[model samples]
Target: MLTITATLRCQGGHEDVLRDALLDVARHVAAHEPDTIGFFVSQDLADPCIFTTYERFADQAAMDRHNTSAALARCFATISPILDGDVVLLTGTELSAKT
Candidate 1:
């Protein structure tokens, strides 16, 4: 399995808008991608514009497919301007799980 965690900081006053857009992307992936194990978008309670997305895929190929999906491309295009900085992507390994 492969896990990806993305942390995004939204421009001041654009938190809600960015959060909504992320939610839409999450729904689209969940409904259309069979290899997606989990997709979650969340907001930091103390820092309003900070958002995080946790995703799990079956493997590296699945993650690559997700990156090439139309839904994600569209979402990135739409949310680019609202971002405060570059999105931070963190990869993780499940210590007990096999790829």
Candidate 2:
């Protein structure tokens, strides 16, 4: 499995935009991409402006399709202006998991 972790910070007041975009696209991804095994999103309790998304894909091809998907593109366009700085992204091959 291919796993992706993305951490982003919003520009203080744009939390709604970030939240909305992420929520909307997450729904889209869930409904449209079957190969995307898991899609999870979270916000930091201590830091309101910080958020993270964890995604698991079946393989590289599945990840590629997701990266090129239109919903994700739209999400990026919507949130681009509100981003505080460069997003931190990490990728890995899943060694093991409970579920």
Q: In terms of lDDT, which candidate is strongest?
A: 2
Give the per-residue lDDT digits (tens) of candidate 2, residues 7-57: 999999999899999998799888999999999999999988999999999
* 10-92 per-residue lDDT for model 1 (tens digits): 89999878988898888888789889888889899999999999889889888988889888888898889989999999998
Error of 2 at 42 (Å): 0.2
Per-residue lDDT of 53 in model 2: 97
Best by TM-score: 2
Model 1 Cα displacement at 65 (Å)? 1.1
Reference-based TM-score of each model: 0.91, 0.97
**TM-score (C-alpha, index-matched) for candidate 2:** 0.97
**Candidate 1 positional error at 54, Å:** 0.6
What would you estimate as the lDDT of candidate 1? 0.87
| Every candidate's lDDT | 0.87, 0.93
